[model samples]
Target chain A: MSSALVYALTGAALFVLGMAGLILQPHLLRKILAFNIMGSGIFLMLVGVAQRAGTPDPVPQAMVLTGIVVAIAATALALALARQLLDMNGEMRLPEEKTGKDRLDV
Target chain B: MRTLLNVTVLFLASAFGLALGWLILDLPVAAVRLPEQVTAQLEMSGVVHPVTAVLLNFRGYDTLLEIAVLLLALLGILALPRHVSDHQHRPSSANPVLQTLTRVLAPLMLLVAGYVLWAGAHRPGGAFQAGAVLAGAGVLLHLAGLLPAWATPGRTLRAGLAVGLLVFIAVAVALMAQGTLLQYPLSWAGALILMIEASLTLSLGLILAGLYLVLTDSGVQK
Candidate 1:
């Protein structure tokens, strides 16, 4: 297999891992981290799949650069919201997910 | 029940992974050869680097919208209600070693950011990367207590935050008088792109750093 294909496969695995983490973990911070991981996986997949034919494609590379910037902005926004929640409620968790001992799972 | 839910989700996620991997493996060679096309139009696109050309010329609208999105994110953070206990206080100065390191390193980082911004025309650097570096320097200064967490930004700071998008939109609207939106004339493309990138670098730096600074002073952490 080509190196790009390997990267793509790893990205797939990472996406799944991130998805699992996003679902299973109750902490807002961990959820944010998982969301970032999922974004990275998507970025990797995009570039890897595009370059899988052995030629560097500037289009996908540029897109990935754009994606990175957007991801960071999204992350920052999420963190701000989480921080706001923490300030108001004294915890960084969704109201729905706060069920007993697992609420303090972090 | 939580364990059962977790197990089921894990199993489904694993299955999804397998499917995604299979789909990736099955992806046929792309019919369109974008690199060749990008190379062919490289001269007209104004920048020697293909990625920069695509980012600021061919796909300039995307970058324009991206700056808007970034600004919106900062605005969203600013819109959040301020905690009453959150005061305009500076973090205590860190260890002398860290402070000294920040003093030495911040200027160097700014220099690097400038170089990167200039180099995007022909190399693997650009406004986004440069802006990120600039923000990193700001974070470092804040961490070392050379800079304080932001309260409300002042007029000059606010103007700086908006300048990039303003310049970008002005350019786009000006170009629209001649033809379609963001379609730069071949003769003016390089200079226009550089101007835009410079403004973008400044604004992006502020916005990115604001994302951090606006949160730190919130007294959120336990």
Candidate 2:
């Protein structure tokens, strides 16, 4: 209803969407992108709540700022690992994919 | 069976989403819980921007560790084995449009980065934003084939990568010697913050661009 609530709801929806993607996507890179989307959802929620009082909270804002940088660092590391995997196998699927352990059919 | 998993995922996601929507709707909207504390110490923190004060003054140790993490990521990227194709080290060709855009935009990005770094004391910009901008400029020049053949040249690159962490540690050690850790002298907080931020911006930009360069270099087809 309120703009803050709207944004927060949208963030929650994004988190769910990302999580679903993470679970469903078979490609390693897609999983990483889904993880990022999930992270962005959490960030959006933080920023949204900070504005709930009609004025922003600077502490959460600073934390979100730090979170963004840390997210990039982690993403870069993940990407490097993914690239290494691709080099080794010439394909982007996880090892678990071959093992069928990634499947939830059980 | 395939349809069953999809249905399960959608149903579970929707349930969780509903719970979150309820939580958001119920949380008190008018509570100015944290800003009061920030405002009380605003004058003493030496920055008009409360976020900067929190980041560089009150919670500086967090930032120090953050820089360390970034450096660690660069180190990790550097440690990865290079493929044989990587040895070619040829610059990717850029079209005339990209070359001209890089020429015009790179300088402007640098200027904007400096402005953002300086403005953090009183505004929304800070070292993080400035550093990202600087990294963006590097990526642009890199894409345009204007950067050096090697993304990093030996010791200078290593030193630049580690300088921000070193400076941050130096400041903390200096403070610890005076019976405090990461506690900048109140009178010199602004100057100290600016000095630290300048070093951090350089290292972060280098680390980010280095990461990108490594990602591109490992013979991965872009």
Highest-scoring model, lDDT? 1
Chain A TM per prediction: 0.94, 0.87
Ten-residue stretch with the least lDDT total in model 2 chain A:
A97-106
TM-score of 2: 0.91
Q: Is the docking of candidate 2 incorrect, acceptable, medium or high quality?
A: medium
**After superposing candidate 2, which stretches have Cα over 4 Å from the reference?**
A99-106, B28-32, B84-94, B149-153, B218-222
Question: Top DockQ: which candidate number?
Answer: 1
Q: How many residue pairs of model 1 clash at the backbone?
A: 0
Error of 1 at B213 (Å): 1.1
- Poorest stretch of ten by lDDT in candidate 1 chain B: B213-222
**Candidate 1 chain A weakest ten by summed lDDT:** A97-106
Compose the digit string of candidate 1's lDDT tens values, residues B61-150.
Answer: 999999999999999988887655646455667579999999999999999999999999999999999999999999888888888776
Candidates in order, TM-scores: namely 0.95, 0.91
